[model samples]
Target: MRGTPLRGAIYGLLAAAIWGGMYVVSDVVLKVIPPFTLLTIRLILGAVVLLVIRWRTA
Candidate 1:
């Protein structure tokens, strides 16, 4: 029970960090890749991650 809050807080911080860094990373990446190409790559990567998580859980 005591570990639950700490785990949640850690997850929250990680989420925040990724969310914050995304804009900066995207800005730099966009200089090299086209906007649509980047968007497509992000979408594909997100889908693959989600699928892997689901597969592992199942």
Candidate 2:
């Protein structure tokens, strides 16, 4: 697929939404977990979700 400008903008907005939600969730998780570790877990989860999407599409 071509990396069209509009496609990039849409993806960027989606990523921003994910990050915005992460900030709020991380704030709540802060009560129980350290920030760095919480971020690590979030990263891992995000990676898994992306991988699953790729797998299904491919």
Candidate 3:
């Protein structure tokens, strides 16, 4: 699309923000929870969030 540059910039910023949040939250959770369990929780949470977004758009 013609908006590729703008799209890329927005996605890059979004990725940075997401990873920053991920690091903070995982650090907190890892103090008590195991890595695998944390991963499952993160993945499921991401999936549910994405599905909700998709449903709204569609």
Candidate 4:
């Protein structure tokens, strides 16, 4: 995988898509929540999700 350029490109595209989706959702949610509050909630939820995934895989 280290030397595979296509695999890296795919990963990059996937990451961009995920972030793009997050931005669009956050944009819509901004009407009901303040920017700081939204950001805080997103950070906490993202951390929890990553931790859960790590725990499960480990």
Instruction: For each candidate, give its TM-score against the true structure.
Output: 0.85, 0.56, 0.57, 0.55
Candidate 3 has an lDDT of 0.91
Tens digits of per-residue lDDT for model 3, 1-58? 5678889999999999998898788788899999999889889998999999999999
lDDT of 4 by residue, 1-58 (tens): 3569888899999999998898788778998899999889889998999999999999
Q: What's the lDDT for residue 34 in model 4?
A: 99
Of models 1 and 2, which has the larger lDDT? 1
Query: Which ranges of candidate 2 are over 4 A from the true structure?
Result: 1-24
Best by lDDT: 1
Q: Root-mean-square deviation of each candidate, in angstroms?
A: 1.8, 3.7, 3.3, 3.1
Reference-based TM-score, model 2? 0.56
Ranked candidates, highest TM-score first: 1, 3, 2, 4
Candidate 1, superposed: residue stretches over 4 Å from native = 1-3
Q: Which of 3 and 4 is the better model by TM-score?
A: 3
- lDDT value, residue 12 of candidate 1: 97
- lDDT agreement of model 4 with the native: 0.90
Q: Distance (Å) between predicted and true CA of 1, model 2?
A: 19
State the TM-score for model 3. 0.57
Q: Please, what are the lDDT tens digits per residue for candidate 2 over residues 1-58?
A: 7799999999999999988997788678898999789879889998999999999999
Candidate 3 displacement at residue 51 in angstroms: 0.5
